[model samples]
Target: MKIMIDAGHGPDTPGKRVPDDSMREYEFNSSTARRVVAALNDYKDVQVEITFEDTRDVPLKERTNKANAWEADLFVSIHANAVGDYWDDNVGGIETYVYLYPGTVAPKLAAIIQSKLIAYTGLRDRGVKQEDFHVLRETVMPAILCECGFMSNHHEADLLKADSYRQKSADAIVDGIAEFYGLSKDSPDLVPGNGNQTIDKGWWRKAMNLTIEQWRELAAELNRMYQDSVSGKIIPPVLNDYRWVEKAYKTEMTPEELLTVMSIIQMRRIV
Candidate 1:
């Protein structure tokens, strides 16, 4: 998938710094964006485009236009939120924004991102909201604007200045996107090729949305089906068609199991 990432504003953007001017918002945004891109680089067939490579300001129009011209599958703009010019300990939380459209995929994506961010960072969830932000309104694909935290908040500003916190935030964002795309870290393609590795909870959590009991039952059923197919009791479905399998059985098999089944089916077709 092609993803366009925008680090909001420029290094010299006025009124974007902490009250003490310790760190700039662009510094935080750019670093987080770079980390996110690095994390996604581990995946195969993922094409990431960054709107700004340097500390220079890129116009909002230019950023959206580049994403549209590239036909990106998704657009993510990252920024730090602020309520006033100075610091306030009371106003700190994470929020995600989508264009005010009922049927678009942006809301769902925004929800997933917001949840993951809160889960990973232990940040307060301000929830997903609809807005007429320029990036959200202009982006061709599903778009989300993530306000990472309150830069005007004293505690959050300090956290934003730290590299570890930035990395953690980036991780949450990428993991959320991976879940949206049904990309499991358990897939051999993501992590090391270990047969004993259990399926990543991401697939089960996002795609299945099943209760614990339901997941257990479905997993048993998938194992039975795989065994049956291998023992010649029944023919396996189309192996080369991942999309079909994904659509047909949304949560039946884990990603690793799906990969194994598809590989076997494809090999059988060739043989």
Candidate 2:
């Protein structure tokens, strides 16, 4: 599949910087866009191209034109959002946008990317939205614009400046695209395992240093948490806490169990 990645805005774009002028929106967008290109390259049968190759703030028409001319299968535009030009701690989250009158594929792709971004970054779920963005409207193929975080929000501004956050955002975007297309990696190590492997209960017990009864108890607690989350009775855990949960039981978790854990984590409200 051919993918076009556009890092929104140019380095010199006016009023696109953080409140303190510490970082430009393109600085984050371009970095994350490059990471997305690098990750997509690892997948088989995938050809990736980035529109913002240099510092020039390319026009929206030119970017979309290139994608259309290239016959790209999909287009993704990366951006850091802002509320006005001032810092506001309360205004922050990640959101993805499709054209106001998008085709079937654009909304689906937007939803996937939105979910992945929130799950991976533990950012606020601003949900998928409709917008009349130039990139979205002009691209012939399915297209999405991701607002990684609010640059006007102090906390998220710091996150946008961090390499780790940019990397996470890129990984989430790539994962979303791969999931939408069912793309597989060229490397063996990245391939998912078949589900038929037998679980060695004894080994897992040793690995987690927990007995069968203890494992059952933990599983029961996780199930309860999942149910509570489903019922909207409790906030979901943060991604870091979810990682700890996964690390604690990954050796023993069945595919089904793993899904349950992920559901619980994603459902948790980020504080």
Best by lDDT: 2
Residue 8, candidate 1: Cα error in Å is 0.5
Cα lDDT tens digits for candidate 2, 81-177: 9998898999899999998552358888889999999999999999999888889998888889999999999999999998678878988999999
Each prediction's Cα lDDT score? 0.73, 0.76
The lowest-lDDT stretch of 10 consecutive residues in candidate 2 is 198-207
Measured by C-alpha RMSD in angstroms, how accurate is candidate 1?
15.1
**What's the C-alpha lDDT at position 269 in model 1?**
31
**Global Cα RMSD, each model:** 15.1, 13.1
Candidate 2 residues lying further than 4 Å off, grouped into runs, are: 100-103, 188-271
Q: Report the alpha-carbon TM-score of model 1 versus the true structure.
A: 0.68
